[model samples]
Target: MTNPDKTGLKPTCREAHRLVSEGMDRELSFVERTRLRLHLMVCDGCTRFNGQMALLRTAMRRFPDEHGK
Candidate 1:
């Protein structure tokens, strides 16, 4: 995870996952989204991870609650 600008933004798979996870909870900043996209473009593993996370998000949204509502 190398920080190209030393601004704490790591353009690596780990960082990409972090960004993706954070994005699920809140809107990522422009720089964060850009960094994550760039990383996903070059990393198949991270790309798949990002897709999987998205799928999980969608599934969770449609899941029934414990009360079975």
Candidate 2:
């Protein structure tokens, strides 16, 4: 069996998950973002995962801790 990490054809799902969260936080490195984009192009599950992440971010922003207390 080929080592997926070396092949770069199958990055670990944990890496994908981390990339998704980093993308959400706008803190991903450029290469990380590019890899994530490539992965999402072929992975429906990651696409839906990103979509839900966006929704969660929007919801959190809309109901923030206003007082900072």
User: What would the TM-scores of all predictions be?
Assistant: 0.81, 0.75
Model 1: runs farther than 4 Å from truth?
1-10
Local distance difference test, candidate 1: 0.83
Residue-wise C-alpha lDDT for candidate 2, range 4-27, written one tens digit per residue: 674584456667878888777678
Q: Point out the worst 10-residue segment of candidate 2 by lDDT.
A: 4-13
Best by TM-score: 1
Best by lDDT: 1
Looking at model 2, the pairs that clash are none
Q: After superposition, how far is residue 57 of candidate 1 from its true place, in Å?
A: 0.4
Off by over 4 Å in 2: 6-10, 66-69
Q: Cα miss at 53, model 2 (Å)? A: 0.5
